[model samples]
Target: MSKRNQKNRQKQKVNYIGGRKSFVRILEEMNEQDPNLIRFYKEVHWSRKKGCFITDTAEHNYKLMLERLDETEVNTENNNEKCNAAFKEVLGHRSGYAKELGHSVIPEPSIALHKNRDYLRIVEENERNKN
Candidate 1:
């Protein structure tokens, strides 16, 4: 074989170690500081053996994790909408009262709404129990 052909073959060769490192590096990069992505990466049972992630079990589990993450995001968005509507309703009622009394009522300090982490934990526990 010519030197050029040998060089081409070497260039085409797969570096398994480098490829493995890149696979993990790419996943980390795609995480983009999202809590869900971070949790998914941390929780998943990544195998050290070559080709383990391509197995049927690993693929199915990964798909399920992705679906769960999507569902959680949708649920969070829905909850946020509900919270905003409720807050608006409360503010409207307060404003109407102030207007009826013909006085400038001092507005109360706004309390920031936050999701209860324990609620999520309970829901997850219940789901696991159901399964």
Candidate 2:
């Protein structure tokens, strides 16, 4: 609050996107010493220790990531299969949608969904959010 202290305070203007604000120290170090610190500025930072990705500390983290990735692929494939089954069932209904439900269909239907793509997309998104 003193005039001398006020004079010592510097004014700064800043803008940031996606919550990735620059640190004051890093800013000062942009033309800085320590090449390793410069390397830090260039890399994308993950709050979770990234050696966990490659190091497998307890081995659990690595396993968990692999599990999630595997589950994602499985779910995608399962959804495609379910959609195809739905398309097949719709064809069986003789509801005049057989052509729309077949291999001829550009976009296939899922096991429990209607023809409109948005509805299926919404269902999938909701499921993902819940998980």
Candidate 3:
């Protein structure tokens, strides 16, 4: 094998290790034509070799693409009326906001914690009053 092919095979690392060009071609074909092929292949051929694998049927690269798409995201300028407008206009409601995991916006840890804290505080106060 040539050095370039060797390099490609090596780069396929987590999956597709020995099938680089064909691997990428499959991705393009699925994206351009039909996405169900990816799902079917993954359902049939996916492997635990990559911890990121969601199913055993998908082709290696197709699974990787799904992972990338799931984790991918969009950029926003702000979190206000203008931002909301842009989100609606450019992104639409349920289209491009989420990553593969399906969340368009990831809430900050602090925000989640604060909400949790508020809920706990309310519960504690209510319990104390009852006692």
Candidate 4:
């Protein structure tokens, strides 16, 4: 190919990559700010006039993006559950230790409420008091 043609191809490649990256980044920000908007985007069909023109490739990318978003949400929930369980286990050990030492044990917070940062801080403060 001529040098001019090669340059054109390189420019097109860069534009394609940049466009795809920006699309994903924008979607992530939108998801973080308002997940309902992402859901609406996924559900609404776009037309050339009403919404932005969407090609077959763009449609496929949208599907993939939604799938990734859903997977990420599920993974996050699982991680949070695991973290809460670990916290509960630690609290259990602390309570047992206090019982052994004849120190009055602080009442454990409900499992559902353990996700609160304030609750975690209170537990940490109680531990420090014991030490």
Candidate 5:
């Protein structure tokens, strides 16, 4: 119950919170090894509550890592194309990208009506023709 541990637990918002440390171990491993750029192995335990292969925290952290990798790939100026490519390939794999709900997470649609105006227009036109 040290301050650092408490902070990480809060920051990670670990999903398998019912007396399990598996998700925390995975996060530590990722932080220590930076395995996103290389092949790595870690055993994942199922959460009885989630009924999935991984916890929500694990999935969320994986997404954060992917974003960091993308930023590194774009910002680095040392001709590190191969390094960046390796990281991207690992992220594309199921182990790195799998989610509790599914393999791919679809982004929510934009809220602005103007952005979806074309689709709305087509629907309205069809409605007019139907009458």
Candidate 6:
């Protein structure tokens, strides 16, 4: 096969943890194993026209999910590793958006900063302008 064909084949391979069924299965396992441990799982949707990610929370929870996945066993197969890869991709996209808005890094502001509604508004406005 040609190099291009080989690359296409690689892309066509099903990602074990990228699918919703497997992702939720792993999350449920984690939750059942330990209810005390906080695990935030949300379906992340991206809007091409809006040029941003949309979720229930106005905040990106990719980093937190990644951190928890690193500590916990997400699946029986090698799916845990693939899940991490998927979340990392989301984090990369989010970081790109942050950079475009002139932020040095993705804002994980302190509690005090989060409480400052004016500051958040300004930051959000900057993101919209950049988009």
lDDT values for all models:
0.45, 0.40, 0.46, 0.48, 0.49, 0.50
How would you encode candidate 1's per-residue C-alpha lDDT over 1-131 as one tens digit per residue?
A: 69998898777422233344443454455446542332333233344664455345445545555554445445664654443343333323344343323122444423332256766678689999999
Cα lDDT of candidate 4 equals: 0.48
TM-score of candidate 1 versus the correct structure, residues matched by position: 0.23
* Predicted candidate 4 versus true structure: per-residue lDDT over 1-131, tens digit per residue: 69999888766411222233444454456557553333334333345354642455445545555554545445554654443343333323344443323223445658878898988899799999999
Give a tens-digit lDDT track for model 6, residues 19-84.
454444455566566421123233323344566545433224545555646666666575545564
Estimate, for each residue in 11-79, the C-alpha lDDT of model 2 and write its tens digit.
Answer: 312111214444443434543653232123223122244432222232433344344434444565465
Model 1 residue 69 CA deviation in Å? 3.4
TM-score of 5: 0.24
Per residue, candidate 5 scores C-alpha lDDT tens digits across 45-101 of 345455653656555545554555555645445424444454455445454433432
Model 4 alpha-carbon drift over 4 Å, by segment: 1-52, 74-131
TM-score of model 4 vs. true structure:
0.24
Candidate 6 has which clashing residue pairs, if any? Answer: none
Q: List all candidate RMSDs to the true structure.
A: 25.3, 22.9, 18.5, 19.2, 16.1, 15.6
